[model samples]
Target: MINRRIMMTSLAAGLIAPAFRSAFAQEWKAKYPELIFAIIPEENASGTVERYTPFCAYLSREIGTKVTLRVVQDYAALIEGQKSEQIHVGWYGPASYARAYLTGAKITPFVIEVSSGGIKGYYSVFYVKKDSPYQSVADLKGKNLGLVDPNSTSGNNVPRFVLDKMGIDPDKYFNKVVYTGSHENAVLAVQQGTVDVAANWWNSDDDSNLTRMAKKGMVNKDDFRIIYKSDIIVNSPIAYLDSLPEDLKAKIKQAFLEAATKDKDAYAKLSDGKDDPFQPVDHSAYEPVVNLVKFIDGLRKKNG
Candidate 1:
C-alpha cells in the first residue's frame, strides 16, 4: 500500500502546513501586538485622521494586531519616524518615500494606488488664479512661486526637476519662492495672491487636490487654471519596514490589495472614490522616482 501511504503523507503535510502557518502568525502577533502607521500631512491633521482611521481599523482587523494612525505635522516628520523605525508602516508620496529610503530607512514599498482611470501615475502641475495674467511659466517670470513641503513629490521635487529641465532656476527666476506647507495651502496662496503660481498634484481634471478641495467647498475649481503639467510621475505607495516578518508583510500587502472589495467604504473615504484600488507594487517600480529625487537632491546641494 505504498500509494496509500503517500496519499496519507501528502494529506498530513497539507493539514500541518496551515496549522504551522497559523501558529507562526500567532507568534508574530504576540511579538508585535500593535503597529504604528504614519501618514504624511497632505491636509490638516484632523482631515488626515478622519480619512485614515477607518482604513487603519480595517488593517487592524485583517492583521490581528492594533494598527494605530500617527498623523505628523509634515512630510519630514513622517520620513523621520519611519527612518527611526518608530513608524511601522507609512503612506508616502513618491519623493518622500524615496527620500526616506535613500536616507537609511529600511522600508519596502508594497502597494500603489490605481486611479479610477486605471493609471498608476499622476502629474505635477503649476496652478494660478483664473483671472491672473500668468498664462504660462514664461508669463510668471519674476513672480512668486508657492511650493508645498520640501519632501513633497508633485509639490516640490517634480516641479523642481521640470523647472530645471527648462533652464529655469526657481531661486533666480522667481522674485520669491515660498513653501506654503501643504497642497491646500499652496492652492490658497495662489488664490489669495500670496504666490503667483503654486505647484501641486493633479491626476485628471476631475480628480485632483483641487477637485477634492472643491468638494469640501475649500476652493472653487473654476477659480484657478493649470499653467504647467509635468510628465507623469509614479503614483504614491504605502510601505512598511523590512524588519517585519515575511508572513506579516504578505498579510499586510494582501489586506491592502483586498481593501477595495472588502472595505469599500474605507477605501472610498481614502481617495473620495477617485482611485480604482490598491495594486501590488515593489521597490523596483519606484527606482526611477528614487533617481529623480537623488537628482533633485544634487541640485539642492549644488545650489546651497
Candidate 2:
C-alpha cells in the first residue's frame, strides 16, 4: 500500500508541474499581442503623435508585431507607465531617464540620439530678445523668467545646475517665475516680451527651437539672443522596460537602430529634420544628469 501511494504522489506532482510553469510564463510574458510604445510629451501631444506615427508603423513591421505610439501626459506619466509595465518602450529626455532610474522604474535605455552635426549632446540655452538690455544671466536680476517643466533636461535641470554653480539662485534672483510647460512656449514668452529671459535647448547648426521657428516664420534667429548655455548635456534616450521578454527586447532594439538610416523621411520627422541617428547608449551616459538632479534637489531644499 505504501509503495502504491508513493507512485501516485509522484505521478500527480509531474502532472501539476507543467501547468504551474505555463501559468508562470503567462504572468511574466507580454499580455497583449501589440506592444505599447510611449513617448513622454517633450512638446505638445498632437505634434508628438504626428512625428512618431511613421516610426511606430515601421517598428511594427520590423518586429513582426504591431506597435502603438502613445503620447503620455508628461514625463511623470511615462515614468509611472514604465513602473507599472504598461509602457513596453519609451523615448525619454535625459533628466527624465535619470529620474526613472532613481525612482526604481524598470526601464533601461539602449539608444541615444546624435544630431546632424554629429553633436552628441545639446545645451540649455538661456535666451532673451535681441533688443533686451540683459547682457548676461547677472543682468536678468529682478526680471521675470520663463522655464519649461522641471523634468526638462535642457529647459530646467541644466539651467538650474548651471545657475547654482554660478552662485545665482533663480528663485530669489528673478522677480517672477513662469513655468511655460514647453520649450516652444518658453521661447515664445521671451519673444513676446512676457519674460526677460527663458531657457530652451540648443545644438549648434541643428534644427533646434529657433531654427525650426524660423522655417515656420514664427521667430527669427536674429530676434533672439542666447545669453547663457549649459555644458553639453547628453542627448535624449530610447529605452525599454526590463519586464519585457529578452527576445522581444532584442528585436525592438535592433529595429530602432536601423529605423533612422532605413527611412530618412520618417526619421527626419522624428528628429525635427536634423537626420540624427539613434546610437547605442548605456545607463552610464546619464550619470551626470543623475548628479545634476541631486544637485538641483539640494538647491530646492536650501531655498525652501
State the C-alpha lDDT per candidate. 0.91, 0.83
Clashes of each: 0, 0
Write one digit per residue (lDDT tens) for candidate 1, span 46-159: 888899999999999998899999988788898888888899999999999999889989999999989987899999999999988888898888899999999999999999
C-alpha positional error of residue 134 in candidate 2 after TM-score superposition, expressed in Å: 1.2
lDDT of 1 at 9: 100
The residue pairs that clash in candidate 1, if any, are: none
Q: Which residue runs does candidate 1 get wrong by more than 4 Å?
A: 1-16
The sequence of per-residue lDDT tens digits that candidate 2 reaches over residues 1-304 is 9999999999999999999766755554456478899986545677678888998888888877789988887788888999998888888889989889999998899988898767778888899999888899888889999998888898888888888888888888899889898788888898888998999888874467778667657678898888887778889998998878776777788888898777777888876777567788999989988998888888888898
| lDDT score for residue 245 of model 2 | 74
TM-score of 1: 0.94
Top of the candidates by lDDT: 1
**Regions more than 4 Å wrong, model 2:** 1-30
